[model samples]
Target: MQLADLRRYGASHTIIQSLRDIGIKDIYPPQLEALRLGLLSTKDSFVIASPTASGKTLIAEMAILKTIFEEVGKVIYLVPLRALAGEKYADFSRKYKPLGIKVGVATGDYDSRDPYLAAYNVIISTNEKMDSLLRHSSPWIHDITLVVADEIHLITDAHRGPTLEVVLARLRQTNPNIRVVALSATIRNVHDIARWLNARVLESTWRPVPLKEGIYFDKSILFDDGSHKEVEVATIYDPINIALSVLDEGGQALIFVNTRKSTESVAAQAAKEVGKRISDGERKVLEQASEEVLKALAEPTRICRRLGELVKYGVAFHHAGIHSRQRKIVEDFFRENRIKLLVATTTLAMGLNLPSRRVIIRDWWRYQPGYGMGPIPVMEIKQMGGRAGRPGYDDHGEAVLIAKSRRDQAFLFEKYVGGEPEQVISKLGTESALRSHILACVATFLAKSEGEILDFISYTFFAIHKDPTDILSIVREVLRFLIEEGMIKEEGGNLKATPFGTRVAQLYIDPLSAVIIRDALFKAEERDRDLTPFSFFHAISATPDMMVLRLRKRDYEKLTPHIVARKDEFLLPLPGEEDQEFLAQVKTALVFLEWIEETPEDKIVGGYHIGPGDMRALVELGEWLLYSSYEIGRVFKLRRAVKYLSPVRKRLAYGVKEELLELVALQGIGRVRGRNLFNAGYRTIRDLKKADIEALTKVPTIGKEMAKDIKRQVT
Candidate 1:
């Protein structure tokens, strides 16, 4: 495939002209052929599975630009992360906006009107936002003529894969002629995906910049292409040794560490080493850049701090913990060669445009539940390796793994560096996600009847040619719940979204929100005014506010010192000299702190602490809870319930209160426990004076001493 061939095969002159304008006159022969013949013939959905840092995104952009120039219909560019969507939106907007193309972004953090959605030629969004837009029946959605599922390989992720699959299936069915462009790092099941979508597969192993794979064993570099050499790890300055070598050769580097802390640690170390090598003037320039970067990193969030630290050192880190703006700065800096090195997490591998001449993997195994310190899948590691080369800067890029032992070195060489990626599987049938989306579909009027809804669902990848025996039963039960709640009414042959349904739709909540709200309402009605509004709100927000596990400090001895220091500084009174109450609260918060530190390195969920994913789920739950309560309040005119709940709703919107610290410090109290205690005649420390000691003990397993201690602590 060649650029000339694409011209001969009827590619729009505009696309060719744009490529030329970007100084890309010579398209790699294979990619050019794929665009000219392979993509042009496709009528079904297809994925371009290729190496990381390949021109897969360019292919997607070409398809999208073609669709935009051909008609007024909208193009939906779906990415996995909010940051990526924002980055892509800016990229596309800068290029196309001046050319009269309007690009809009709808990510998780922002919500705008549907009218604006229609006005934009391209809308870049996260999958969740896209799902929300669809559920809200955004008028512009139907105007979509093209959908690009970037990072399409995520269809295999358990938590989000089902949502992506359902959305894609729904979009394709709604507009049979809509062009679908699915881009992914090389996956094992390109054929399976192609067969499912009935679209042509343009699979490539070609790299615009060559990537060389090697293992560091016994201080030796062992190359994979039947070429072997020894690189002593001990004699090597650090992972930055290879990075400095690349830069000295006039190329940049992207070093991936498994954690944010490691990212910062490595960047600091690399900057010191790289600093010693540069001229005084160059060092000053780096130091100036580093100062700006440090300011951003100090912003409290993990990503900002990491990037900030890296920028100060003329290096930066990329991860989810940092805010989006800081991540963008790092990306822009790297893209323009302002920053020479980036110590990042696996997030850097996910379709971001920054490429480097060297990629060093600090750790290959991450901890996960049921398997501690397990090997990363070959596919993911490959994606990181694929980012090793820069198209214009380097003829070859080096990917190095630091191996502690020969066995480890062998594992890296044979299993990760030399292996194919795993097959992509469908997540359509997962109960947790499926149940929510199914209810969402009913609420949105996409599923109108038991039979019609069933048929519509059958079109999903989950039900495609699979036995629906259990699925049918599940859908029936959900529909019955809808009817019982008066959310839907069967009229003639169609099921209609009643007033309640409309409210849920308007609020953009998950069905699980309805479930939680119904439970809360039942409890409220059983014992009127017994349930504190904040308790319900907390329940809804807890999942989303779950913190990442903090990494264990090197000195467990320092833990107590830090706790004592914090209490002294804050002037927090303790129950006794031992300060058990304060200690307990510190421990609880530490649990969350530790969880945040470990989450990136350990794929542990529900690991004794809550994290961002859990927090997101909770936020959605809270929104749904409020929406449901509002609807019920409207129906029965329960003004009091609505009034009492409003403040709690406001609290949830803003965030958990600092008073939650006092609540967390109470003995035998978790989030739920604190909520229950506060609701049960114990709203404040003074209220404990009014309670019967024995009776308080009897309240959910508290004993006499525990009750006395709680009271004493509160006082």
Candidate 2:
């Protein structure tokens, strides 16, 4: 259908005109198929399963825009990542908010309920954030008219799939008439997902930019269709040469490496080639972007220092290890073609809009300490390929996998390049996922009995193809555990959540974590011992909600002595460990101790051999776990423990000592400035309130303007 024809499907002339203004002259085949299937005519669900760059996002935008203008209800677009949420929110707000539709975004920051979100006509959110909203029972949720689930193929992901499942299930239950539009990459058995949603399936392999998938082995590209091309490259093992080849063809390239270190190493190596070819203007843009990255650090971390070096050469690496602000700078420069080559980990495949003309997969295997090295899923291989063909960039794109020899090339091509993706299955039936979900259902009153709970879960994609008997046994076991912990009471064959259980659900914490926290508090109160921050960190780390530090053999040897010294403080005994698994909590607690003691970010990263992202994630998770632990103390009536844990949460949050809590509570001050102020004799808010700007500016980390702002806050 042409852009003008969109007016026939509830689109106004203004909307059609705006599409044309943005260079969207016509709808693709998959979108036209969706329209023909009555996508805009009724309040129905749909699964638009199509190849990447097939205009699936456009189809979703059309449906949501029309619904918001024609209907008087809120619309939600759920994505799997915070980055995607931000991207979609910016896209929708720019296009539709000018049409008088309100748009807002919610990802996380758990302190605020964000009740103001009800004022918006459209809200973009992460799946986990939407789940937390549903658990909170947001009042506006009941009025939702449309929900767009982007990357619905994530149902195969073991860790996060179940959260998406529960969130979608609850969205439907909240409003039985709500329309769901699920967008997916090409996965096998799309019909299963369509059947689960009770929606019409619109599947297509059409792409605006066609893809050429092949294997790069022994200086030649072998295509699946019996086509072969001999390419000139500088070094057989140098991925940079392939990228340089693309640059010579007047196109960009993306290199997918196996690890974060490889991402930086490859980006740096490629920059040496690309740097020799960059224009002065391009070098200036790259310089500005590199400066933005360096500005993210008070004293640049190693990742920032390396990123700064590469960006100046029109090259960048993207991974979770870099800071978010630095990541955005890299993405912006790459999008504008200032950065010619980007080396990234698998994170770049998970729904970011940065696309390239050539995608080179440097590794097809990933290493996990628990599982060792294993081949990636064919679906992941395809997802990485999807990033090659942007909607409007190139006429065609190339995706090649690196192979050492003909034997490896033949095996990889047969297993991945020439094979179909695996079917998407439900991970909701897994014990860890189901335990929290089952408790959520009972606590939120979505289900009052075993039969009701199972029936509700039966709507999940897991129940569509698998045996219900398996989930039944698991559900029963989880129910027994909940009852044993007094989280739920069974009376007259009906399950009811206790007050503590209701609070736990309201807090959006795992019930198992809550139980763990409660037991620790109970033990402390029973023993009548004073608890320290060391013990508090250990207690919180024992819960699954926080990511524990991975201890190496040397770490185990060193921390065993640390744990032995603090034996009397812990509610549970800290065992000296030989492997990472046993004394993981002790190692995590050590990190927390270092954090509150004002350890520099670089020193923390160096000591742990972790990146900036790991330290940030650990601190954030510690805040949540500590907050939950404090609340758990209330459940057990441990007043003293509550008081102790409350301040520790702030200490963890700001990476500050206890004396700096008052200063960190304000908007702009953090550990650096807070410590400076504390040492300068302005130890608390009252001290700041009474101090002059000159006195405040004498503190090393505070400037005249910042000191005035700090002084003004109290006056």
Candidate 3:
């Protein structure tokens, strides 16, 4: 079917014209099959099971534009990650704004008081942000007409699955007639998901660029289709060798490694190989990308320097360790074909619109802290493979797994190449996920009674797949715990969220996080002792949201003594039940305390064995939890801790000590500027207000324009 034919399925002329303008005159075969299956035409929901880059997004675009054109209502396009949300918002806004569509993105900040998205025709958000909005009972959600769940298969994800499942269930309950659209990659038992959403199933294995799967051994790749190709190999791991071969063929390659360290190592190695082959023009392009990398980092962090050095050879690495903007720059460079190779971690597997002619799986086994090393899931392997074959650029793509031995080669082929992707499983009934959602439901008055709460939960994917008895039992247990913790209370035989419960939900923090904060505050206030930042850091690190750093044996031995020495300074006694987990939390808190003390990032990484990604993650989660802890402290009347925590939270956020908190609040200011101003006799807003623009500009890290901006802010 032609793209113009979508008009018959209720796509407006503007939509069709937009499609044509982008050279999408003909609909891809898989999307055509879905259209024939009444994906956009029908009022019912749809679960589109297809490969990545197979026009799933276009199908969703058609639906979103069609629904908005009909004046049906506002549309919600849900993506799994903030990056995907930003990408979708940009794409939709760019293409459809001219066609009279108003698109808005909501992520990171969930200010319930501001329904800024109400004016938008289409709203793009992450699953968690959407869930938070729903919990806040945002007035705009009820107006939602079309709901698109991109990466619907994430329902199998244990950490994220419950929120998606419960959010969908709530939307279904609130707006029963709302149209749902789920776009997914190939997964086993697609019909089960279809059954959960009450949507028609459109299954297509067709790829816009046909993929060739193979196993690489001893410089030769044995294709699954019984074809063979000899490739050069001079390194121990031949991902770089395979990538060099792909570059020789005039196509880009994506090398998937298991760790960030491997990504940098492989990119550096690949750059060395490709450097010799780079042309002058290509060298110029690489230089531009390198400049952008440095510009993204003011002081050129270690990761930035490494990335900039590698990109000079038309090769780069991407992982969470790199800043988001820097990563986006790398992606843009790769998209323009200036970069020949992108070495990445499992982060690439999650819905990024990056495609290449060749994908090399450098590691098939992943190391988990508790489980040692385990083979990668078949679905993960498939997701990485799906990155191959840019539709317009490559006629065909290749996905190959590397093996060192024949026995290992056979196992790789049997387990990943020949294996079927796993089916989605519901995790809605997990104790913590269940508790958080249940509190949200009660706090927002979505479910007033136990029966109503049960009914609400009954609509989840967990209830659809399993017996109700188990879920009901878990819900009751969670309710009892919440009541015991003073988050909720039972009155007149109906469960009601207390003021504390409502605050917890409004803060978008886990109920268990509040519990830990309350316990820590109570213990601290119970006695009259000094409360240190390390004490509170330890408290927040043990919360569900904070990622605990792993403590090596030598590190643990070093920290164990410090922790023991500082035992009196901690608010609550450390948990004695789980020694290892407690020690890890202590290690995490120590690192955080060091961070707030203005420790150098590279020094922290070297001493604590934490990555840039982990530091970024730690700061973000720690700041939020600190705010939550402060609010909870205020609620419980821990006056001393509350006063101490307020300034400390600001310090944690701006990466400054308490003295710079007053200056960091100004516009065009951050840690570096905040410190500079403080060191330059501008310790507070009053000092800044009294200073002249010349004095401000004389301060280190502050220029004329920035000084004027600071003056304006202070005055």
Candidate 4:
């Protein structure tokens, strides 16, 4: 359908002109189907299920613009990942800001209601963030008329899916007239989701660029259509050989592996071959990009150095281990076509728009804890393959799996190349998943009794597939746990959250984590001696919300002595000496201690066998959990624990010792700069107030502008 046809469905001339300005002359098949199903004229919800790069986002854009131009109530766009949230926020803000539409994003600090979002015409947020907003009873939520759930298929994810499901159910239940437009790339149960939402289903297999699936074995690719092509590159490494062949054909490649180590090693090998193919002009551009990646941290870690070197050859590996700044540099360079190849783990498949001309699945089996190596789900494989073809760039995309033998080749083709994506089941049925949601329901006054809680559950996708009796049993168990934990109380026949319960919900932490922190605080207060910083760090690390580091073989020997010496200082109970969980918490706590002690980033990452990115993530979570513990303490009125936690929280946030906390409070000063000024006879903000900019500039790593900023702040 022509873009102008949208005007017939109440679309304004301004909206149609905006589409024209962006060069969108024609709508794709799935978009046309959605519009024909009363997308613009009716209040009914919709599920747009289509292949990647098939204009799924445009359909939502049409709906959003129509609502904005018509002055419909506020709009909420939910994304599955924080990276996707930022991408959408930037795109929407840039596109719609000219139309006088206010766009806002909320992805951090789950405790706040972010009342400023009320001024925004459209808001972008992650699933967890939105859920936290709802739990805090943000008043603007009642004004929302539309919500777009991007990647709705992720409701099947075990860790994050429950929150997404709960957010959708709460939004629908609160605003019966609100319209939802759910988008999914690969889902076999799209119709079931549609029925659950009482919405129309628009399912299509059309792609903007054609896709070809195949299997590679013995340097030959056998396409699913019975055609075969030979890869002439001579290399001992199969992935490098395949990637180089794609580069020879004037196209970029994405290599998908199962682990972070594999991504780096594979990219390192490919970098050698890729470097030989780059022209001098391209090399200069890549060298600049490489330097930017390397300098992302003040002190580069080992992974940073290796990644910087690889990017000089137009190759980079992506995983959660790399810091966000460096990851953004790599993504932007690849999108600009400066980076020829990207090697990544499955994280890259989570709705980033970085597409390549060819996608090579180098590993189909992933390690599952306690389950050994297992085949990846067909849905994830397809999502990775979907990154092959850029909509306007590649005429056709190739998604090929590597096979070791004839038998492996046949299995790869049968299972993945020609397979249908799996059906998505709701992951909201378990006790661990339902505990927080159930508490939130009562905390927010969404439900008052057992029947009301069950009614709320009936709105979830879980209820559609689960037996009512099974759900009832689980709900009862969650309620009992909450009651026993003193988070909820039964008054007469109604249910209400106690002050502790309300605070826990508002903190957006696991109810279990709050309980853990509460118990630790009370126990520490009962003791006589002062608690050390390691005690608070280890206490938070033991919570379910914190992602503790994995214990290595050498960690036991190195950690045993310190743990044993500090046993009395720990807030939580000590496990046996050889216990893996105890050792992991000890290791994680030590990392936090080193961070606050102003240890350099490289040494911490090197000693802990982690990437700089991992350290950054752990620090961020540690800060939040520490602050959550403080908030819990305030609720319970634990005077001593709260007094100690406030300063420790600051130390964790600035990555500085307590003595340097006042100096690090300045705008440009960090751990390095703070320490530099202290050792130079400037210990506090008073010392900075007394010094001139010239004297401050003499300190290491402090430039003239930094010095001026520091002087301006202190004065």
lDDT per residue (tens digit) for residues 1-715 in model 2: 6677765665677657656654577778898888778877766799998877788999887787667666777889999998888888888878776567889999976534678998998899998888888777777888788999999999888877998888888877757788889999889999999988899999898888989999987778887778987767765455778788888888899999889889987887777779987999888888888889998866578778888988999899988877777888888888888889989896557855688999999889998557988888999898898778655668888898989988999898898888999999888886788877887788778999999888888777887898666678889998998899888999888999987877787777778888878888777776656468888888888887878877665786788788668878897654545546558888888889999999987888878777787788788888988887887678768987787778889899999988888889887888887888888888889988889898888889688999888977878
TM-scores of the models, in the given order?
A: 0.75, 0.95, 0.96, 0.98
- lDDT, candidate 4, at 66: 75
Model 3 lDDT tens row, 521-610: 887676666678888888898888788887787875787687778887776665663488888888888888887888877777778865
Worst 10 residues of 4 by lDDT: 346-355
On TM-score, the candidate that comes out on top is 4
Best by lDDT: 4
In the range 1-715, model 1's lDDT, one tens digit per residue, is: 3454565654667766665554456666445745655454344456788887667777777777677775556899998887688778888888877667888998762133366677888899898888777777778788888899988888887767887887887787677788788887789878777665666788888887777899876645677786765432322455777677667777788887776567767777777665555566655765665555544421133333444555655677666554455566667768877678888876446655677877888778776544577777778788787778777778887888878888888878878777879988777664555556666676676777677666666666666446555577777777777678767788997888777665655554554555455455544444443355433442333222222233334324544775455443221223443444334444444433332232231222233333233434444445445555666566556566566556554444333343443554566554434555666657665667777787678766456787888778766
Residue 343: error of model 1 in Å? 1.9
> Number of clashes in model 3?
0
Per-model lDDT:
0.64, 0.82, 0.84, 0.89
Model 3 residue 271 lDDT score: 74
User: Which stretches of candidate 4 lie above 4 Å from their native place?
Assistant: none
**Candidate 2 Cα errors over 4 Å, as ranges:** 7-23, 109-113, 225-227, 527-530, 690-701
Between 2 and 4, whose TM-score is larger?
Answer: 4
* Residue range with the least summed lDDT across 10 consecutive positions in model 2: 573-582
